[model samples]
Target: MYKKIRFLTILIFALIITAVLSTGFIYSISITNAPSKNSTSIVKDKGSENKAVNTKIKKLDSNSYNILVMGDSLARGTGDESNRGFANDFSSLWRAKAKKPIKVINIAVNGDVSSGLLNIVKDQQNLQYIQDSNMIFISIGGNEIKNFRSTDASSSVVQPNNEKAVQNSYLKNLENIFKLIRSKNQNSIVAFIGLYNPFGDDLTADKLELLNEWNYKTEDLVSSYDNAVYIPTYDLFKYNSQNYLAADNFHPNSAGYEAISKRIFESLKNFKN
Candidate 1:
C-alpha cells in the first residue's frame, strides 16, 4: 500500500509539471502573435508623413504662378544697380499685388537678338519651361537695331530702305518666335516689351520715324495673336530719358525698371480681366 501511494504521488507530480509547461507554451504564442505599440506608432507616423507631403504638393500646384522671361539685355536687367531687371521687378510687383507665390525663370542672355531668342525657345529645357509657364515676357529687337546701325555706318544714320529690310527680317523672326512659343503653350499670355529710344533728342527725325514705324508694325503684328500684346516703352523713355536711362545711356536704370514693371503689372491685370 505504501509503494502504491508513492507511485501515485510521482504520477501526480509529473501531470502538474506537464500542465505548467503547456500553459507556458500557450502564453509564449500569444505574446508572439500580438502587435507591438511601437510598431503601430511607426506605421501611423509614416502614413501621416506621406499625407503631409501630398498636401503640400497639391497646394503648390494649385496656387503657384510661373513666369518665363526671354531675350536681350533689358530682360537680363543689365544696367540696374540692384540687378533686379524688369523681369524680377515685375515678378515682385505681381507677387505683392496677387499675394501669391511667383517663380520666375529668366533665360534671357545679354545681347541676344530675336533669332537667338528663337533658338533658345527651341531648346528642350526652355520648351519645357514654356510649357509650364503661366506668362512669358520677351524683350528683343533692340540688339538687331544696334547691329544694323553698326553695320550700316556708311550713312551715319539708318536709311529708310535698309531700315525696312531690317524691320521685315525682325518681324519674320518675331512671328516665328511666337509660333514656337504658342506651339508649346497656348494658354500663356505673351507680352513683348517694345523698344525705347535711348538716344532721345540726339537721334535724327528720320531715324526716329523708322523706329516709330518699327514699333507700329510690331504692335500690329502682336495684335494678330489673340494671347499676345505689345507693351510700348518708347513714350516712357523718350521724354524721360535723362531720369530713366542708366549711366551707360543705353539700358534702363532702377527707376526705369520699376516703371516697366508697373506698366507690365497693369497690362497683366487687364489681360487677366
Candidate 2:
C-alpha cells in the first residue's frame, strides 16, 4: 500500500509538470507571433510624419505669390533680347517692391491665338497651375487679328459685315477663356494685356480703329469681373512705336517689356487698396 501511494504521487507530479511546460510553450509561441508594441508605435509614427510633410508641402504662406502666365508670343517674351519677357520683368519688379516670395509659371506659346490658348488651358497640367496661381496674366488675340489682317489686305476699307463676324468669333473665344480661368480660380487677380497697333508708324488707320474697338470690347468684358483688369498696351506702343517695337516690328523689345512690367506693377498697386 505504501509503494502504490508513492507511485500515485509520482504520476500526479509528472502530469502537473507536463501541463506547466505545455502552457509555457504556448505562451512563448504567442509572444513570438504577435506584433511588438514598439514596432506598432514606429509604424504609426512614420505615417504621421508623412502626413505632416505632405501638409507642409501643400500649404502656401499668405504673402506668397504664384503667377500663371498664358497666351501668345507676347506672353512668351519672344522679341525681348534679354529673354526675360514682360512677365519675368513684372515678377522682378513685384519682388523688389513687395519683398515677398514669388513663383512664375509661364506656359505661353509663340504665335498662339485665343482659341489655341483656350485649348492649352484645358490641359490637366495647365489647369493645375491655374488652380495654384494667385495672379494670372493673358496675352492673346494679337494672332487672331494678325491672321485676319493677313488674309484681307483690304481690311482698311470699312467692311462692317465681315469685320463684325471676326469680332464676334474673337469675343466668343475671349469669353470662353475668361470663363475657364474663373472656373478654376475665382479669387485670383486676372490681367488681360490688350492688343497694340504695331503698324502705327505706317498709319494703319483701319487697323487702329479695329484695335481700339477690340480693346473697348475686351475692357468691357474685363469690367464684368470684379478681380479682372485690362492692361492696355495700345497707348503704350501707339505713341512710342519706334522705341517699343522689336526688330520683328510686331513683338515688344526689352525696353518695351520693361515699360509693360512697370505698368503692370503699378496696376497691381490699386488692388492693395
Candidate 3:
C-alpha cells in the first residue's frame, strides 16, 4: 500500500509540472500576439501637441490611389535581396485586395531619420505626392535607438535617460511630421510603422522593455490622429529576428518583409472596413 501511494504521488507531481509548463507556454503566446492589435489606436486628440486636429480626409476620388512610402532603410528595403521591401509587398497585396490601381512612390532613403522624413515632406514635390495620396506609410524612429548602444560595446543595456531623450526627440519630430502631412493632405490615411529590434535573442530584458516603451509611445501618437494608424512589427520580429534579419543583421530579409507586409495589410483592411 505504501508503494502504491508513492507511485500516485509521483504521477501527480509530474502532471502538475506539465500543467505549469503548459500554462507558461500559453501565457508567452498571449503576450506576443496581443501587441499586433494593441498597437493601433484610433484616437483623435493629436492637436494638443501640434494644435492641428487630424482632419477626416476623404478617400481617393478616383479608382487609382497613390501610396507614399517614407523613412529609413527599412522603408527602402535595405535587407531584402529583391529590393522590394515590405511596403512594396504590401502595395501589391493592397492593390489586389482593394481592387484599385496603386501608384507607389517610395522615396525612402537607406539612412533616413524622422527629421529627414520631415524635410522630405516639407518639399513641394513630395507634398504634392502627399496631397494626392490616398495612403502613406512612415517607418522611422528605430534608428534613433538602434544607433545608440550601451557604454560597454558588448552590452545591450540602454541607459534610461538616453532612451527617454531619444523617444522625446522622436515623438517631437513625428508630431511635426504629422502636422506637415496633414497640412498638405488632410484626407490621406497615415500609417506609422512601429519599431522592431533586430537583436532578437541577443536583446536583454531591459532593452526589450525600452523597445516596448518606444512602441507604446508610437501607438499613442498614431492613435491621436483621426486618419492615422500604427502597425506593430515588434512582436512580429521579436521571436524570429535572427532568422528574419538580413546578412547585415539589421533590416528584415525577404521573409521578414513578407511577414510585416501581411500584418500591415491586415490592419489596413480592418481600418478600411
Candidate 4:
C-alpha cells in the first residue's frame, strides 16, 4: 500500500511540473529571440561610447537548455524603470547569441538575501519548478543584514560590525543551496553574483566604507565555491552612484542593471563547454 501511494504521489508531481513549466518554455524563447546588443547599456560623449553587459538550457544532445537565476531585488529587475529588468535583457541576448535556445528561470524576489533564499528554496513548490535547470545563478546577501540592523544598538554600516563572522554563517547557507541543487541535477553549473555597493555620497563615509567592505567579502566568499563564478557589480554601480541607482536610491536602473547583466554574461558565457 505504501509503495502504491508513493507512486501516485510521484505521478501527481509529474503532472504539476508539466502544467507549470510552460512559462519557463516561453521565457526561454524570449531570451533566445533578443538582440545580443540589446542587453548592453552604453553612455557616450563625443566619440566615446559606454554600454552595459548581459544564460541557457536543454537536453543532453539538444541545442538549448534551461538556466535558473535566483536572488534578491537585483535579480527581480528593480533598478530599471522599464520594468523589463536585466534578466529579461540577458535572456534576450542569449537568444540572439546561441545557435540553440537558452531558457532562463528567474526566481529572484524583491528582498531576498541568503537566509531568505534558503527559506524560499525549502518551499517545495518553487523548488519543483527549478529542478531541471541546466545551470543556476544566485545573487544573494544584500537583504540579510537589515535583520540585525533594525533594532540593534550598533550604528554599524553594513551589519554587525564584524562582517567576516556573519559571512561564515552565510557561506554555509550557500553550501546548503548548492548541495540541494546537486541533489536535483548533478550536471547543473552554478554561479553566484557578488554584492555591490548601493550607498554613494548619500551614505555616511563610514557607511560607504562598510558597504565596500561587504562587497569585497561577498566576492571572496563566492570565489571559494567550486561550481560558482563571482560576478562583480560594485564598481559597475559605484563609478557613478546617482545614475546607476534607481529613484529609490538602492537598486540599479535599466542602464545599471544592464551593466550587471553584461558582467554576468561575460563571466559565464563559457558554460557551453
Q: Which of the numbered candidates is closest to the native, going by highest TM-score?
A: 1
Answer with 1 or 3, whichever has the higher lDDT: 1
Model 1, position 68: C-alpha lDDT score: 85
What are the RMSD figures for all models against the true structure? 10.0, 8.2, 26.9, 22.1
Clashing residue pairs, backbone N/CA/C < 3 A, model 1: none
Q: Residues 82-177, candidate 3, lDDT per residue (tens digit)?
A: 888887898888876556777778889878888888888887667777888888988998777775545464554355666677678889999998
The TM-score ranking, best first, is 1, 2, 3, 4
lDDT of each: 0.82, 0.82, 0.81, 0.69
* Candidate 1 Cα RMSD after full superposition onto the native fold (Å): 10.0
Candidate 1, after superposition: displacement of residue 114 in Å?
A: 1.1
TM-score of 4: 0.65
Q: Is candidate 2 or candidate 3 better by lDDT?
A: 2
Clashes of each: 0, 0, 1, 20
TM-score for all predictions? 0.73, 0.72, 0.72, 0.65
Candidate 4 residue-wise lDDT, 1-273, digit = tens = 999999999999999999789879998999898768746545555654532211112223244667677888877777688886666677676665555677666778888767778887776545664566666778787776534333244545345445656666777887787667766666666767666666555455554565566666667765665666777777787686777788887788888877877877888787762
Worst 10 residues of 2 by lDDT: 51-60
lDDT score, candidate 1, position 237? 92
Query: How does model 1 fare in lDDT?
Result: 0.82
> Candidate 1, residues 64-182: lDDT per residue as tens digits?
68888999999989889999989888888777655668877789999888788889888877887888888899999898775443334577436657677778888999999888888
Look at candidate 2 and tell me the lDDT of residue 11: 100
